[model samples]
Target: MKVGLYFGSFNPIHVGHLVIANHMAEYSDLDQVWFVVTPHNPFKKKNSLLDDYQRLEMVYRATKDYTKLKPSDIEFKLPQPNYTINTLAYLQDKYANFEFALIMGEDNLKSFHKWKNYDVILENHHVYVYPRISGNHIETQFDNHTKIHHIDAPVMELSSTFIRKAIKAGKNVKPMLPEFVWEYLDEMNFYK
Candidate 1:
């Protein structure tokens, strides 16, 4: 099976994330799309994130109904400040029968070159990119790269940071999240 790994902190899983993952699962050749909840991203600050399991629970709540979508806590066991390349290598070894790919936004593509062992990632796996509203310019080397496939998915500007801020401000951001996720967050009283 071909699986696409969609990595994120998922501070709280929202509809925008579901849309993209579902689009990749349904519109692309990937048999499954795993939401790899990162425990700690090297690029992001730890204080802004919820506990790893909480974020994973939110992802679970968001993807439970979709057979093609899954929530993975693979990074939780990995070393701190793990890189995508390391996770990719680990997954490749563990699931030898399954082919793994990456699902990313166009904005990430702009800085793809800066990632550790990026060339190795490109050499081993395919990258599926969805459009972003950001104005950043993508690297020229990736323009027509055979390993990279640009998917024409919807442009999702909705973000977890925006949702968190709204919740802290006592705004109704319920509609931005999945019903179950919203209920979980409401029960847990997160962000507020």
Candidate 2:
């Protein structure tokens, strides 16, 4: 089976996330898009991050109805400061029958070289990058071994930070998130 790994914090999963995953699954060769919830990203700041388990639950809730989209807590069991290369290695070892590809925003592609063991990842994995407002400028320094595919998906400006701020301020997030996910967030008082 071919799987596209969509890694993110998923502080509170929203419609935008689902849209991209659906797009990838429907339009690409990938059979499924797994939301790999990262416990802590080495490249990102630690402050204001929700608990990993909580984030996983939100992802689960958001993606429950989509058969092709799965929320995975794989990174939660791994060591802190989760690295994509390490996760890819682990997944390959655990699921030898499955072929996994990386799914990320165009922004991440710009700094792909800064990631741990980037050369190995580039050589081994197929990356599907979706366009984002930032990080569209690609450098010509990438190695030839990397297989990068650009995907065109509708851009939703909503972000986890903005959603969190809205929730904290008691503002409506109905337009930003899916109906069910918005309900769950309100019931759990997430981002409060």
Candidate 3:
């Protein structure tokens, strides 16, 4: 199976994330899109995030109905502060028959070169880049790279930070989240 790994913190899975994942699964050649719930992102502050299992639960609740979208806790089982290169290597070894690709926003592409063993990742897997509103400059080398594909997906500006803040301030951000995820967050009193 051709799978696109959509790695994120998914502190509270929201509609914006669903839209992009659905778009990739339906519009692209990818057969499925797996939302890899990262336990901790090296770039993000750990304290700001919810419990790893809590975030994973939100992801599972959000993606339960989508047959093409799956929630993966693969990173949770792996080491903390994991890099994309290591995850890619691990996935490649475990699922030799499955072709794995990356699903990322345009903003991340700007710093792609800085990733550890990025060259090896580019050579091994295809990167499916979705549009982001961020006006960051991308490297000229990846502009026309064969391994990098710029998908004409919608620009999702909504972020988990915004949702968390909104909920904390006693705002009804239910519309921003999936029905089940909203219920789960509300019941758990997360971010409030």
Candidate maximizing lDDT: 1
Better of 2 and 3 by TM-score: 3
Task: Compute the lDDT for candidate 1.
Answer: 0.92
Q: Best by TM-score, which number?
A: 1
Candidate RMSDs in order: 1.9, 2.5, 2.0
lDDT of each: 0.92, 0.84, 0.90
Cα displacement (angstroms), candidate 1, residue 164, comes to: 0.3
- Residue 72 in model 2: shift from native, Å? 0.5
Off by over 4 Å in 3: 41-45, 134-139
Residue 139 shift from truth in candidate 1, angstroms: 5.6
lDDT of model 2 at residue 181?
75
Tens-place lDDT digits, model 3, residues 145-182: 99998888887789999999999899999889999999
Please list all clashing residue pairs in model 1, or write none if there are none: none
lDDT ranking from best candidate downward:
1, 3, 2
- Put down candidate 2 lDDT per residue, 49-141, tens digits, no spaces: 877787887888888888999999888778876678889999999999999999988777768888899778878889887878663455545
Clashing pairs in 3: none
The order of the candidates by TM-score, greatest first, is 1, 3, 2
Clashes of each: 0, 0, 0
